[model samples]
Target: MMRIALIGTGNLAIHLVHAFETCNATQLVQWVGRSNTPPKQARDTPYFTQYQNNMDTDVCIVAVADDAIPAVAKELQHIDALVAHSAGAVSIGELEPINRRGVFYPLQSFKKNAPLDWKSTPICIEANHGDDVILLEKLASQLSGSVHQITESQRLQLHTAAVFTNNFCNHLLGIGQSITTKAALPFSLLHPIIRDTFEQSFASQAVALQTGPAKRNDIRTQQKHLSVLSEADAELYRILSKSIFNTHNT
Candidate 1:
């Protein structure tokens, strides 16, 4: 079994701990955090508040914050085992002092205390050497069926796209919920429509499936929507309406 040491106590680290528990080929040897308070989920695993240069492990995963990754990598440079970070946008070169360095980025937003299906998650990996790449891929494949070798630049682009697809869309859903609540209507009423929109988006271009006052350039209906919204919501509505109109009309 491949012994692994994880260095972080954040959401991603929690998810990784759970994933490792499910993988028979891997054993989580240690979990390093800033405090001695062991992660609630990793109660049985060994915990360390400081980096131990002598810890023997097949792989050491640095799952810290993006900005802290470089410092963590530099600190763990003395270790002989392969060191990898879990940042999508951070380059592998951040681990400059370490000869054996790699990236094992999981392309999904992690929430604390939430259960995740590791099998369906996509893992993006990169390494300084070809053999290290193979080793990283082998380890990632145990947790995810879709393991991709993506460059740092490509990973950054993917992360940007994810913000648009996931974050931005979720924000819009929140706005929709607020509108429904203000109108004293159940937000559940929008569930079917939201589900249909996603289902249709997969079958064709989103622009082609668009059907709203903005898509039809119905200024009267747009003005009606703006009249009912608060100042902030009205401004947002105006901007989105104009964008939708311009996208299809211009």
Candidate 2:
């Protein structure tokens, strides 16, 4: 079995450890971290808190904060193990001078309280060598069927798209919830609409599935929605609606 060293004890690392442990072809040998540590409940095997002791593993996966990745690479410069990081924005060049480097980015939002099926998550991988890419693909195939080779530019584009789809969309939902709550209506009323929005897109292309006053160019209803929202929310609604309309038209 190929030995693995997991660096960092964050949410991503936790899920990865669970997935790797269950994969028969790989052995999750060590977890390296600084003062931060995964909770006792998360510990299924031995883990080390120092970098020096982490050198024994065959592969080193740096699943730390994006800012810390360079430092991790510098600290482990002497070691020849394959080094990889879980960053979407940072390019493979960040791991330069390391004999073996690759990207093992899992494209998904994670919450510690939520249970995840690793099989459902798509893994985005890239490497300098065909062999390295194949190695990553084989390892990622153990957890997920959706694995793809993406260039650094493509990965950055995907990351930016995720911010709009996930983060910005969630903020819009929060605004909707707050508006409903302040009007003495249950936020649950929005649930059906939100659910259908996501569900329909899964069955059809999101652009083809678009619907709303803005999508139809129904200026009258759009004005009514703007009047109902507070100053900040109204501004946000107008900007997003304009952007959506522009996007659909173009």
Candidate 3:
């Protein structure tokens, strides 16, 4: 089994600990973190609060925040292993002078200790050396069936798209929830339509699945909604309705 050192105790790190532990091809050799007390999952694993100059491992995964990655990498410069970070937005060059720089980005939003189908999650791998590419791919393939060797620019682009799809979508949903709250209606009222809309989008073209007063080009309904909404919300509603109408009609 390949020895792996996991550094960080954040959301992604927590999910990764579960993933690396369940997989047979790799072992959690070291669990490095900033806290003196390791998380419950890391309690049984070989854990460390500080970086060792001569750590022994096949792969050292730095799954910390993007900003903290550089400082963490600098500390592990002396370690003789393939140092990788679990960041989609950050580039592999952040792990400078480490000799074996690698990007092990798992493209998904992680919730600590939540159930996740690791096999389906996309693992984007990158490396400074060609041989390291094969090694990283092999490791990632074992944990996840969907593994892709993407360029740094491609990974960044994927991350940006992910933000629009995941983060922005959630924000829009929150806005919907707030609108329901104002009218003294439960958010659950929208749940069925939300579920159906998501399923329909995946089943076929989302553009074709679009259904609303705007998509149907009902000017009366659109105007009524705009009049009821706050000034800021009215502007947003107008912009979106116009886009939807144009998308379906033209």
In TM-score terms, which candidate is top? 1
Q: How would you order the candidates by lDDT, starting with the best?
A: 1, 3, 2
- TM-score to native of every candidate shown: 0.94, 0.90, 0.89
lDDT per residue for candidate 1 within 1-250, as digits (tens), equals: 8889999999999989988877899999988999867768887888889867676798899999989988887788788889999987788899989999999999898999677888899999999889989989999999999999998899999989889889989999999999999999999999999999999998989879988999888988888888888899899888888898899998
Residue 230 lDDT (model 1): 88
lDDT of 2 by residue, 51-143 (tens): 655346666789999988888888777776778899999988888778788999999997766888888899999988888888888878888
Model 2 segments beyond 4 Å from truth?
Answer: 36-38, 41-44, 53-55, 248-250
Supply candidate 2's per-residue lDDT for 127: 86
| Inter-residue clash pairs, candidate 2 | none
- Provide backbone clash counts, one per model: 0, 0, 0
**Which scores better on TM-score, 1 or 2?**
1
* Model 2 lDDT, residue 83, Cα: 82
RMSD values, in order shown: 1.5, 2.1, 2.2
Q: How do the residues 154-210 of candidate 3 rate in per-residue lDDT, one tens digit apiece?
A: 999999989978998897898898899999999999999999888888889887777
